[model samples]
Target: MTKEIAVLGAGSWGSVLASVLDENGSHVRLWSYNEKQVAQFNETHTNPKYIKNYTFSESITAYHDLAAAIDGVDYILFVVPTQVTRSVARQVAAILKDRNHSVNIIHASKGIEEKTYLRLSQVLSEEIDPENRQSISVLSGPSQAEDVVTHDITLVTVASDNQRAASEIQDLFMNNYFRVYTSDDVIGVEFGAALKNIIALGAGALYGLGYKDNAKAALMTRGLAEISRLGTSFGANPLTFIGLSGVGDIIVTATSTNSRNWRAGNELGRGESLEAVIKNMGMVIEGVATTRAAYELSKKRGVEMPITSAIYHVLYDGADIKETINQLMTREGRSEIG
Candidate 1:
């Protein structure tokens, strides 16, 4: 049986996922708010603005109207920016309430809510009416759009407390090139997803500041420790931090120049202003906002996140990069396992 899937937010990642779903014999509907982009997709199956030199699968239809796009679809995958997740989810809920439909909701975006400090999955579940939501799951890892579109071997994890729902998502997305795994540790998976972006920024900063491999090695090693500490304080599984969503994601995002967050951090490390960087990048660099969320959450939970603190000060408080690094390096020592 063929499944009908509606993918919201037809940006680079969303477009790539839409293509993958269509290739797997699913009827794909990709939604975007931009009418011009939708027209471009329908006419040429190309999104040159965001994804250069690539053509989307012609079978995947693009929609400008949200209601029409999701009409009768079995699954809704959100690739929208983290900041607007709730508004979009509420809109989805209103539409589903009228239709009396329940659909599996999944998100590929990573970031914590700036104000609420909730995970994107939590935000989605809170907004979508229970009657209209079959389940809320998250797809997160080091998976990149550019690589996945070219049929590069990519592995990701989908997580939900609902075992059946998690397995269903795993089966729906797995293919020869793209492999999927399921986990019940939703909290850990999400924390790994949202928090790793901050560390990636720091990694790129270290690289930009003329630091060599040893600097990056220390940053990542200690970075994972901070991520685990904060996450476990909030009821996440410590082992999840070692899995694909945790260390695997950190390895890819922090080290890869393809990552928007890494690139932004590179610019920041070279002494550019955050405002200027954001203007030039023209992409949602999630790590900036995620750094803020995690910084605040750490204080509230009394969790010591030194790397996050340094990045937060640099990004939000206008602290000098070198001074922030020096401060972090000189912090009081503790046992490695502490």
Candidate 2:
């Protein structure tokens, strides 16, 4: 049976996911906030501004109207930026309430809300009424849009407290090239997904600052340690950090130029102003905001997230990058396992 799916957001990741669903023989309606871009995508079957030179399937339809996109869809995929998730969720919830409809919800965005410090799934639960929410699941891992579009072998975890919902999403997304795994550890998966981007920024900064492989290795290793420490504090399974969403995602994001967070950090390390980097990138660098949220979370929970703290200082406090590195390196030595 063909599934009717509405995909919110038409950014690079959203567009690519819509295409993948189209390939999977799903009836996909992709919604974008920008009307002009929606029309351009409908006409050209391409999103040039985001994913250059790649054409979407003709079977996929683009929409600017939220109601029209969600009309009669079986599933709704939220792929908007993390900061805008609450606003979009409100709109979606209102529409669903009015229509007396509920659909399975899947969120692909990765970031914690800055002020509330809530995970995307938590934010969705707050905005969307329980009666109007069928089930909520998160899809996260190391996969990149650029690679996935080319049918590269990619693995991701679909996590939800509801086992049936997680299994359904895994079936919907799995293919020969795109592998999906199911995990009940939603907290671990989500935290792993969100926090890796922060470390990716640090990795990129190290590269831009002319640090060698040894430094990058140390950063990622210690980054995973901190990620696990904080995640487990919130009742997450510590073993989840060694899984795909944890170590795998960090490896890809921290090293790849395709990561917006990494690219933003790279620019910052090369002496570009944060404002200039944000303006030039023309994409939401989630780690920039996630760093702040995680920093606050660390302090509130009294978790020692030295790497996150250092990056937060560099981004928000305007601390010298070299000096921050020195501080991290000179911190009192401790055991490898925290």
For every candidate in turn, the CA RMSD to the true structure comes to: 0.8, 0.7
TM-score of 1: 0.98
Q: All candidates' TM-scores?
A: 0.98, 0.99
Report the number of the highest-TM-score candidate: 2
RMSD of candidate 2 to true structure, Å:
0.7
State the lDDT of candidate 1 residue by residue for 69-101, as single tens digits. Answer: 999999999999999989999999999999999
The whole-model C-alpha lDDT of candidate 1 against the native structure comes to 0.92
Residue pairs with backbone overlap in model 2: none
lDDT of 2: 0.94
The candidate that achieves the highest lDDT relative to the unseen native structure: 2
